[model samples]
Target: MATKKTSSKEAHHATLDGEDEDATHALELLAGKIGEPPRSSLQAILAGTTDADLVSVGKTILSSRIVTDAARIYRKAWDFYQEASDEQRKRLRGFSKPLLAVAVQQALALEQLDRKLAAKSTSAGVARAAHEKAAEAAQSRAIELRDQAYDALRDAAGRDEGLRAQVDAAFGTATTSETLARGLEQTAKLLRAWLGSDDEALTARLGLANLDDSYAKELATAAKDVRNAAANATNRPADGKVTQGALDRADGINVLIMGQILRAFEGAHGIDPTIPRLVPISTRRLFNRKTKKKAGEIQPPQNGNGPQPTGDGETLSDG
Candidate 1:
């Protein structure tokens, strides 16, 4: 009677405990057969289950399904994230090369501009220095010339009386007109030689060679006038004679020649000469007309309206 004490529910519980190791294998086979669990299956299990063992089992199964679905969703999201990351990297790579090249080119352009600006600044500095040097040289030359002119004028004004007397005595006791004229000519020659010498720094400084055309023309005219005046002075009546005036005019002519020499120096040194207005050669011409032919050399006029020679041996006369 003790051996026959078999409770069915207790026996089932004992059997389930003994087959617990095979539960996972059995679930795998069942999951394959059912394809996948329905979304409401977990809810149905939660509602029906009341016993602690059954509820725990239902919860474990539902939790496993939820974990698997969550894992699947997480895997999909990871894949999408990877794909988006890959696309972003591709876009960044595509833009990076050109942007890097543009940055490099801009840096090079800025460097070149900086170099060019530095070179221009250096060249401008050199040009300015050169111009200043040239200006200083020109100014120095002007000062030297002014000093020389002042000295020459002062010396000429203070002619030595002893030298004049010695010169007069050397000519002879009786100073004839011909002897006096010869002596005067020799003195003029000496003066001309002194003034024309290159040793005179004033001549070089004054730029006499580059006289303006107007000034040169005026000097030439004045020279001609002086020569005419000198001739008139020599041939004038005793009362009409103006010896002092003639000498003064001659002196003026000499001064004009000296002025021309100064102008030439200025021209050589690239300076413009200060002079009177220029005169054209043809301005003072008395006759500038072209010659006309005489009547005897004129040609006779042709008479087209007088008569016409007709064709077919007939002549036509004007009405």
Candidate 2:
């Protein structure tokens, strides 16, 4: 039998078809295209494995001011159009006037919040109530616009079955991109809180708060270095613009931060622990003793009571 090598395109398609590793890679690629914070946040949300995860993810999505603003715009337009007489709606330009109206509403709501905020002086209580009401309405509109977008995309997909996957991927990318961006911002806030206080009870419990001043400063400095390096690395030109040394430096800092994030995550409870691993290129390398260090050194088994390797690379049985 001949061994068949899968092409990169085929592998990517496989991810859409449900291969775990490839799907994860596809998501990572999607995040990269979407940009940082959102990408990591999106990955974390996707990796969520419990009810608590869902709740955290939900809050992240709901609290996105951008999404809320977009929703409000669509809702305001929809509401205005709904109140219009049939003749008035007909007077609006375009064949798909209704759809155009919905899209315009999305754009319009960008300024809606500002206008509402500016109304604060006339009557504080009334302004607050109106603001809340507007947010609720906007949220509803956003949902409606979302449904409309889905319907349009799906309807087109039905006509061209071959494009279904593309359509679905596009829709998924857009929705997840927004959610991920919002989640990333939230995650940043959480990180700042964690690193802000040396006497924090949680840090104390984790035995991190007791670290000597020098060690703590070193850890903090390493984090800052990693962050700066990452920003530079990601912004590098695709046409071989950045030097190899710069890339290597970024890689080194990444390894440093990975350790810090994992250590912190293992001790915390409020956020998803595995979210750190979602950072772009944040992969753990398994120890390959055969290739590095000694050729004959024994390695301990991670699980099961299987025969262990002895010194000089021979297998030994304890039983």
Candidate 3:
């Protein structure tokens, strides 16, 4: 059977659709094995995971600070394994660098995906606020420049109806950005022409010689900010609405390696009991206790369960 071929653009968007049922199904499977932590041990993860759904587990493991702190855990953990001593390597039996590598890649993918989701919610709003602020500033600048020039003209053109008429035409009390911008341009042109006149006494009297350089540049930059920011207010990532299913699936994939990460430290207790701290954000602390090494031979756990999770550490509790 000949299958219809898709164009490159179609293929690209197909990848973006984020409705991969098979990948999401795997997340559903991974979410099931997040064994309940004891009442006094790693109880934090359990609270967030009471529902034990895919997105919930993903959200449980990842707090609000994914872009900066939570996301760095993956690469840092990978580095720990990269420099693992021979004994440390042996400790993490059944766990290979390839597996951690795969986990890190998945972690990176999920991190970027989450960031895109977050930006979609806030970008338009942020740009709108910024545009308003820039426009307000520009309006103020226009008002200031126009008023300063107007007052100069008003005082000089006292009893001179011609120049006073020009000032009236060039300056207005309206405060909108568009109104202010148009009035500012007219006021600047009149001031420049007045300053260039043969009347040195008038130019010096109004002190309008440098209006072209200082006033125009400052007002122009402010006006430009308003224009550019207005564009951003409209053009910001238009498709900010990410699907709930996509978010849930992303969250699932994010924490998919939780059980395997735990299994990696099954015998890694002796190597660094202080670390390989599971997930940097996890409340589950593994191999943090001081274990005994009998006669240089790594002693097994007293209960023989091996490398029990400890209570105290610098682990993240969402605290």
Give the number of the best model, judged by TM-score. Answer: 3
Off-target runs (Cα >4 Å) in candidate 1 are 1-95, 158-319
- Candidate 3 — which residues are off by over 4 angstroms? 1-115, 173-175, 208-213, 216-222, 234-319
User: What is the per-residue lDDT of model 3 for residues 60-165, given as tens digits with 9 covering 90 to 100?
Assistant: 3232222222234444555677687877777776466555544544544554565566555456567678877765665565566667767767776656688789
TM-score of 2: 0.17
How does each model score on lDDT?
A: 0.29, 0.31, 0.48
- After TM-score superposition, the amount by which residue 289's alpha carbon in candidate 3 deviates from its true location, in angstroms, is 49
Clashes of 2: 5
Over 1-319, each residue of candidate 2 has an lDDT whose tens digit, in order, gives 1121121111222222333233334333333332333224323422423333222212211111222222332333334445766654443332123332322332222223222322332244464555555544543443443344344434433445544454344333224323423322333333344345464543443243232334334333433433344344334233333322222222222222222332332223223332221111102121112232322112233464322212223221110
TM-score of each: 0.23, 0.17, 0.39
Deviation in Å, model 2, residue 252 alpha carbon: 60
- Candidate 3 or 1, higher lDDT: 3
Ranking by TM-score: 3, 1, 2
Candidate RMSDs in order:
56.4, 37.6, 16.8
